[model samples]
Target chain A: MNKNEIDNANKYLSKFARLTRNVLDEKELISLSQEKTLLDDYLQMEQLRFGFKYEINHSEDLDLENIEIPSMLLQPFVENAVKHGISKKATDGKINITFIKKANDLALTVTDNGNGFDTEKKNNGLGLLLSESRVALLNSIYKENRFTLAIQSATNGTKVSLTLSDWL
Target chain B: MRAILIDDEISNLENLRTLLEKHCPKVTIMATAQSVSAAVDAIEKYLPDLVFLDIQMGEQTGFDVLKLLPRRNFEVIFVTAYDQYGIQAVKFAALDYLLKPIDIEELINAVNKAEYKLATQIQTSQLDFLLQQLKKTDTHVSTIAIQMQSETRYVTLSEIIRCEADNTYTYFFLANSEKILVSKSLKEYADLLRPNGFLRTHQSHLVNPKYVKSWLKEDGGILLLTSGEKIPVSKPNKETVKQALQRQ
Candidate 1:
C-alpha cells in the first residue's frame, strides 16, 4: 500500500458522498449506510476478480460531525482501486483503508499493493476532477477548515492520504 | 359511469364538464387533473371507468401519463385539435377520439360507444396493443375528422387551415374555403392533433400547416389563414405556432 492509492481513495470517497447527498435525504443516507456490509461483499467479489485481498478499518468513535463530509465519499475510490488499479496486476495484491481522528483533524488513508503510476505527469480524469471540485466546495462551506491530499507511489504499490479539519 | 376530465386549460375543462353533464347524465366526473402529477394521482385514486384525456400538457404528453398507470382499466377518449395523421392512427387502432369544440352529438355518440363497450365487456386490449405498436413504429398521424352538416367528413392531411371552438362544436376551416363542424371540445382536438401537424394557436384555434397566410403581431397577435380569416392567437401558444409555421 502506498500514499497515492490512499489519497485517490479518499478523494473518490469525498466526491461520492457529496453526490449521494444531493440525491438522497438524511433518512435515505442512514439506510444506505446500513447497506455497507452489502458494499463490502461486492468489494470482496471484486477483490477476488483482481486476485487481491480487501480490508477496511474504522475507528469505533470516529466523529462524523467533525468532518462534515458528503455521503459515501470513500467507497468509489476503494472500488476503483480494486477494479482498475489492482485487477490489472500480475500477482495477488492487497488494498487496506484506514480511518482515524488525529487531534482536530480527520485523516483517511487508502493503500493498495498493486501497479503504481507517475502521479506528477498523469492528468486526473473526470472522476478525479469531480473529487477535487467537491472537496473545494466542502472547503468553502467550512471556511476555517483546510482539506489536504497527498498521493505517493513506488514501484511496489500506491498510498493516498487525505486530512480535513475537525470543524468540517 | 365514472369519468375523469384532464386538461390544463380551465375553459376546456369547463366546456367538457358542461357537455358531459348535458349529454351523458349517467357519467359522474369523479375527478379532474390539471397536470401530469395530479392526473396520475387522480387516475390512481378514482380509477374511473372513462377518462377524457388531453394529449399535450406542457412538457409531458398524455402518453407519458398513461405509461405511469398500473394498467389500462379506464377507457381514454382523446380530445385534441385537428390533425389528419393522428385521426388516421385513431381510426386504424379503432380507438374513440374526438376533435375540439366538442359537438353535443359527437359527445353523446362517444359516450354511448363507451357505455356499450363497457356493458358488453368489449376488450380494449387490441387497441392498447395497437397504440403500443404505433408508438414503437413512430407512426404519428396529423389529420382530424370534420362534421359537415349531419355527415362526418375528414379533411385531407394537408388541406386543413385551422379549427376554432364555438361553444360545444368545433369549426374546421380548410384550404378550399370550406368550413366544417365537429362535435368535440378544443382540448380533445388539441390532444389528438398535437402529435400531428396541427398546433393549438389559441384556446379556440388549432391551426394547420398548409393554410397559415401571415402572422399579425399587434394586439396579442393574430394568424391570417389562407382563407383570409383572422384568428386570434393566444399568448400561451404563440411560440408553438411560430415554430410550426417555421417548419412549414
Candidate 2:
C-alpha cells in the first residue's frame, strides 16, 4: 500500500480503538464528571471531523461531580443530535447538552439546531429504538419508575430530554 | 468503441485505464477526468460511447455530473464503493455498474453488457429511469415510472390495485379499472413495489394489501380484494400473506 493509504488506515484504526474502549467501559458506573468529560471529548472528535460546535450547561451548586450512574446512558441521544441534526444542516451546526436540576429529578437534554423530522414515524431508524430500549432498561434498574425519555422534533430544531429521579 | 473515465482518485482512474487496456481491447480510452467539471468537458468534447463513472468525486457526485450534462447518448457503467442505498437504487433502476476495488471479471462483464446494450439499443430511455430511481430511493412509495411503447407513464402507487404477470409482460390493474400492459417483467416491479403495500400472493399475481378486503380459507385460500377480484394464494405463500396482513 502507498504511504497515504497506510496513514489513513492507521488514523481510522486509532479512532476505532478509542470507540471500542468506550463500549468496553459500558459495564461500570460513570460519574457525572466522567460523563461530562467523556461526552465533551467525543464532541471534540466529532467537531474535528464534521466541523460542528458543541455546548454544555451546568451550575456550580449542582453537586454533580462524583455521583455514579449508568455508563453510556446518554451516548445514543447525543449521537442522534449529530447524525440527524448536525449532519443534515448546511451551516453553523450546533448541539447543546444541558443538565438541569429538577424539583424531584435530574433532567438531561440534548438539543440540536438542525432541521428535525417526524418522531411519530414507525421506521425512523434503529438509533431511536436502541435509545428507547436503553432507557427502559435503566428504568427497571432503579427502585422506582422515575426515568423518562421524550423526543420532540420540528422544522426549527430537535430536543431530546431524559429525566432521572433520585439521580442527583 | 471510445470511453471516458471519471474518478476523483488518480489511482483508481489509472487502475481502470490499465484494466480496460489489458482486458477489453475493443474499448479505446478517449479521455480521463478527475472531477465532475472535467468529466463534463470530456463528455462534450469526445461524446464517447461509454462512460465509466465513480459516484463520489470530492464535493460533487456522479449524479451531479449527470445533472450538468447536455446530452446522454452514451451509456454509463457506474463504479462506486459499497453503498447500500446507492446500490439498491441502481439495481431498482436496472442500470449497469461495477463495484470497487474493481474486479477483473465484473469489469469485463459490465463492459460487455454495456457494449451489447449500446449495439442493440433495446431500451432507449435509461437516463430518465435512472433519475426516477435516484428520486425514489429517498422516500416511501409515492409514484412509479413505467416505460410505455413510445413514452413513459408516471402513476401514484395508491392508484394501482394489482399487477398480473403474463410470461414476460406485466399488466397493472389501476383503480379506474383500466389495465396498462408494461413490457418489463413482474419480478422487477415486485421488488420495487413490495414495501409500498404490494404483495406477491401468487406466482402470477402481485396484489396491494390495502385493496384486500377478505380471504377465504377454502380451496387453497383465495383473497377477495375490494375490486371483487379473486386472487389465488398458493399454499407456500399463505404464511407470507398472513404476515403481510398482520403488519398492516
Candidate 3:
C-alpha cells in the first residue's frame, strides 16, 4: 500500500481497538462524550471501509459533557444510514448528526442523504428493531426521563431522532 | 388456499415447501418456479391465492415477475435474505415479508395475514401501491395509509395540518377541517411524517410546516396554523420551529 493508505490502515486499527474496548465495557449507561467518541470511531471505520465516499456533518451546542444516555443508543441509526442509505448512492452521500438541548430534553438526530427505508414497515432492519427494544428497556429502567425515537424516511433520505425528556 | 413459491435457489424453495407442509397445512403448494419467466408462467397457470417471492434471482428480480403480470389477483409475501433495497421497496409499498432462515413465528404470522387478506378478498391496494412505487425513480410517496378501527384511510401528506397525541392515540388535523383520531401512538406518526415536512414542536404535537401560519412568542411559545388553530411549542423546540418556519 502507499504511504497515505498505510496511515489510514493504522488509524483504522486504532479506532477499531477503541470500539472493541467500549463495546466490552459492560456499562448500561455511558456519558455523552463516551457515546460521541464511540460514534466517531465507528463512523471513521465505516468511512475507511468505503474509501471515504461519504461525508459527515454535525450541528450541535457544546453542552454534552454532563448528560448520560443508554449505551450505544446512536450507533444503530448511524449504521443503518450507512448500510441502507449511503451505500446505494452513486455520489455525495452525506450523514448529518445533530445534538441540541431543548428545554428539559436533549434532542439527537442522524440524517443521511441515501435511499430511505419505509418508516411505516414493522419488519425493517434488525439494527432498528434491536434499538427500539433497547429504548423500551431503558424506559422501564429510567422511569422519569423517557427516551423517544422518531424516524422519517423518504426516497431522498432518512432521519432518525431521539428525545431524552427531562434529561437536561 | 393455493400458493406458488418462487426462488432461484432450489434449496430455499424446498425448505419453504417443507415448512409450509409441516406448519401451514391449509396452504397447498400449487406451483414452484426458479426464474422470472417460470414464476410468471406458474402464476398464470395455477392462479394461486398467494405467492411467496424471493427478491433477488440472478439477473432478474421478483419485481420483474410481478411486472409481467396483468394485474394482482392474489396476495404476495416476499421472502429474502436481508436484501436492503428489495426489503425497503417491499416495505415502502407496505407488503408482508419474511427474512431468510425465517422465524416460524414470523412465517406463521405472514401466512395468517395472507390468509386473512385472501378470506376478506380485500382490494389489493397495497400491491397496487407497491407497483406504483416501483415505477417511480424517486423514493417519496404522496400519501400515507392510516389503519383505523373499521378501515384504512389513505391521507394525502400535503393536506395534513397537525397531529396531536392522546396517550396511546393520535389525532390528525387536516387542512379541510377534518380531524382523524387514530389508535396508534403519536410518536409513530411523528417518525413517519418527519421527512415529509412535519415538525414535532412539543411532546404531544407534530405540525406540517406548510400549514403553519405563524410562530407566536406568547405563552412561552405557540404556533398558529392556517386553520386558525394554535399549537403550543415547548422551549426546546422553539429554535427548531423557527428554523423550519424560516425555511418555509
Chain B TM-score of candidate 3 stands at 0.82
* Over 4 Å off, model 2: A1-168, B103-105, B121-123, B132-138, B145-189, B202-205, B226-229, B235-240, B246-248
Please state the error at residue B210 of candidate 2 in Å.
4.1
iRMSD computed for candidate 1 = 27.7
CAPRI quality of model 3: incorrect
Second chain only: TM-score per model? 0.54, 0.75, 0.82
Model 2 misses residue B164 by how many Å?
A: 5.5
Docking class of 1: incorrect
lDDT of predicted model 1: 0.65
Error (Å) of candidate 2 at residue B101 is 3.6
Candidate with better lDDT, 1 vs 2? 2
The stretch of ten residues in a row with the least summed lDDT in candidate 3 chain A is: A57-66
The digit string of per-residue lDDT tens for model 2 on A12-82 reads 44444445555674345554655786787577667757888789886554544433456787888888888
What tens-digit string does per-residue lDDT give for candidate 1 at B82-165?
A: 444344566544467776656466678899878877776655463455356457555644433443333335455577777777
Best by DockQ: 3
**Range of the 10 consecutive residues with the lowest summed lDDT in candidate 1 chain B:** B143-152
Q: Estimate each model's TM-score.
A: 0.34, 0.50, 0.57
Worst 10 residues of 2 chain A by lDDT: A6-15
